[model samples]
Target: MVLYFLALVFGLHIVMVNLGIAFSTVIPILKRKGEKENNEIYLRTSKQLMNFYAATYGLAGVFGTAFTVFLLSFYPSFIGLAGHLTFIPFGIAILAIVVHFFAITAYWYSWDKWKSDTHFLIGMILLISVYLIPLGFRAISAFLNLPQGLELTPKPHLDVVAALLNPTFLPLYLKSVTAALAAGFFTISSAYMLKYGKGDKEAIKIVEKFMPLATIAFTIAIVLGIIYAETLNLFVNYKFENAFGFLIAAKAKYDFSWLFIIKLAMFALQTIAIVSYLKIRKAWRFSKYIVAAGPASLIAIFAGEMLNSFSQYPYFVAKLADKEFVSSIPQPIRDYLAERLNLELSNPLATSMGLYTLTLVFLVPLLISAVIFLYILLFGKERSEALD
Candidate 1:
């Protein structure tokens, strides 16, 4: 239950956060070019994306914080040790988040105030920071898996440097880059499809330009993911006999190739949807295929996550150590959940509270926001007037 909830919230949050990074970087470039070319499409698209990013940014924060709280609450004991060792990475992440807030706020609000070069420079740093933010996160996650630093157990304490240098850190970070780019570009492309899916040539052109990049990034993401998994298989003690089993015969144990196959198949269809439209421009001028890419990308991402998590079952952080830590949950709660829900529980108490927070805070706002978004979509001018 905990793993599923974490996956649900964490996966959604990761997509939105990376999308914010992607569009934030693109908006300034598009703004500059739009000014030079006197292209209303570029200008309007940037503005719309800015509004979308601003709105979703708040939701991302909510989910991200919720994710952290659940982690701490569920694995209080294990994370206490892990957190002490991993605090440096978390510290770096928090500092980055602070800078990110101010940078993005300035970028978003100072559009009318700042000069072009100055604003673009800020946007560049903002992109750098956005990309840098994930490094700390993935590093910490990697440490949890490999935990080489924990083994160091320095005289004073754990070596922060060694912890950050976990074997899987670089590979996972590289893998995450693919997800960030693919998600980000897909977000931009989908937004274009939504706002101007009504036979707008400029909008279609923008979609054409961005969708291809999204497809390509997703392809690279798959390749990087394979490399990362192979690195993990080599490094981590707990092996997935089922992962890459069909392709890599030596690794085969059972019929666990199904998820891997489906994840690839979904992305393949997505690529075909994007490419087919690119080749046949006239017939697909306003094709649903363009909009269809949104769902396809999301499904692919979710499926990939499911496959990754499923391959490593029954262990929260498995590594070669004197002592191995299993799932982080009370035994009674874990047993109850297993018997009743046929699911594993990480932190039942945290899950209960987190669900409340998710419902009241995130879910309610989502409902209200959905209605408001529909109003904006259906009647932007009128809604803008009423809000004003």
Candidate 2:
């Protein structure tokens, strides 16, 4: 259950972050074009979209902080403490939440009146700063794990700050940013199809203009993702050992033919989505296909990340001490379960959260299907008209 929750949280974070970047970059560019062309509808829609993106950014930060705290609670030793610790990363999380609130306030109240140039600059700075804060915390957390074990002390000859500053960090950051941009572009493309595409030639023209931007953003994201993976391989080889090492060893034993096939399939789907957007100029038929393709690629990326995390599992902190620390069932909990119920310590993962698994398997898909059906029923005409 915890793993599933974590995956969902991380997936949402990736989507929202990318969407925020997409709106931040693409909106301004489009707004400038709208103004030059004296296109009021385009200007209005762009501003509204920008405001929505800014608001969603705050929501994402709030959820992100909650997820971070949940993760910390699950493995407190990751920060060098048995329980909560006043680490620099935690401090940054708090600061990010505060900044996100301010950004949301600025976006909400400035709807009618144009913000002063100074205020707008400040708002932009705050938004960008908040966006990067989580990345910084993640990098720090990963670095602090280099020593491994239950203690917070820095490992011999290993500096957490120095590890945080390694060459790999910059590439990772860029990769994440580009990924966010791709997500944003994909989302905006969907929105354009939903809200504007139809027999409305003007709306189709606007969407057509945006399609190339989305395609370029997605292309950059994929390229950067590949580069980032290479850097990660180097990091694992030069600085680490353990299950991750085991997994790397396993990967090395086999040619990545299957992985390459998956990558190619993802790339082809994304390319098809872009082409559909360029040619269709409508939302009715191919919008869901595009949406699914974008997220499918994202899921593949998540699967790769999961493999890395699994390599580091059981040991919350790695290579920090002479011996690795593994989590144990608390004696009290174990005793209670033993006396009052039949418990299997050897296979906890299978039985730990039966209810959650059931809910995910049955409820989530049903809900999505119902929603999609409702959308089609209500908006089918609009979609058809847009396409016509």
Candidate 3:
């Protein structure tokens, strides 16, 4: 129950933070190009989207807090070890977020400050920092999963570079960055589609570019994921004798191969669909297909996360505290944490409870988003021209 709750919060955090980061990220890119091309459309759209970026950034902080609370409360021992082991990356990430917050704030308000390049530079810095932020997290998460980082002791010492560069760090970082980019660009396209409908040319262009880009990004993610899976397989094969035959996990007791297959099919179909749509972009049905890109990519993202989660099974990170066959220490470690941190929820989600909880969790956001959409529609608070 606790893990499920945390997963929900973290997933929402992922979506929201990715939205904010991607929107702000595209701003500088578009602004740089807009200035170069003398294009008003790019500059105007970037400014308009900044409004929503501010909102997403604020909401993400809320979910981020929830995620931290759940992590500390539910998985104290694991996170305790994690915090000590990857302290440097985690520390840097905090500083980065602080700077990122201030940078985005400055960029938002100084749009007409007669320092266009400087403002864009601020956004570029924010963009780079936002990109690095996830890498820090993935470093810790990957370490936790693979137990690949320096094993902490009563008196632990971390080698900053080595800790930040855990065995699973690069693959996980690339995979997540690709995922964020896909989500990020699609989000931009999504905002336009929902606001202006598919007929808007700028919206159409964004939709078109993001579609193929998402397909490419997702494809790269798949490749990186495959490499990560092979690494996991090697560990399993060594520990459990040919589970993946050194190519897949030999721990086949519960297989999510089907989920992986479905995810692959979705991406392949998305690519094919986007390519077909682009080729005959004038077709009357083009709008619908372009619109479909957003949902397909989102579903792909969900599927990938689900498959990864199930594949790891009992461990938050595989083998960290796993107590199956030859693994049995995770539960004991949790017990060591005392009452507040020690929680054992045996899939406490009854079917009815599951349905009810999921409905409420999803509906609240849907309603809030609907209200925001309507507010933007009514206000028509469009962008002003560049500072002259």
Query: Which residue runs does candidate 1 get wrong by more than 4 Å?
Result: 155-160, 194-196, 237-262, 281-284, 320-388
> Which regions of candidate 3 fall more than 4 Å away from where they truly are?
152-154, 190-198, 236-251, 256-262, 281-285, 321-388
Give stretches of model 2 more than 4 Å off: 28-37, 54-62, 79-86, 115-119, 141-161, 237-264, 275-308, 314-388
Which of 1 and 3 is the better model by lDDT?
1
Q: What TM-score, over all chains together, does every model reach?
A: 0.79, 0.65, 0.77
lDDT for each residue of candidate 2 in 114-229, tens digit (9 for 90 to 100): 64454455456555755666565556545434422222234223344665665555565676666566656665565555554344445445456656776887788778766755
Model 1 lowest lDDT segment of ten: 320-329
lDDT per prediction?
0.66, 0.52, 0.62
Counting only residues 3 or more apart in sequence or on different chains, how many pairs clash (N, Cα, C under 3 Å) in candidate 3?
7
- Compare the candidates by lDDT and give the number of the best one: 1
Cα RMSD of all models vs. native, in order, equals 5.8, 8.0, 5.6
Better of 1 and 2 by lDDT: 1
lDDT of 1 by residue, 1-388 (tens): 5665566667667766767767767777777788889987787777666666666677778778767766665655555555556677887888888888787788888875889788878777677777778888887768656665653213214566887677778878877777767766776676557656654566766776677788788778878887788777777634345555665564543335677787677677677666766675655455566566666666666666566555555444535221333244346544432332222435566667656566457656754775586467435775444322
State candidate 2's TM-score. Answer: 0.65
Worst 10 residues of 2 by lDDT: 337-346
Any residue pairs clashing in model 3, and if so which?
Answer: 145-317, 243-249, 243-250, 244-248, 244-250, 323-327, 323-328
lDDT of 3 at 298: 66
lDDT value, residue 348 of candidate 1: 62
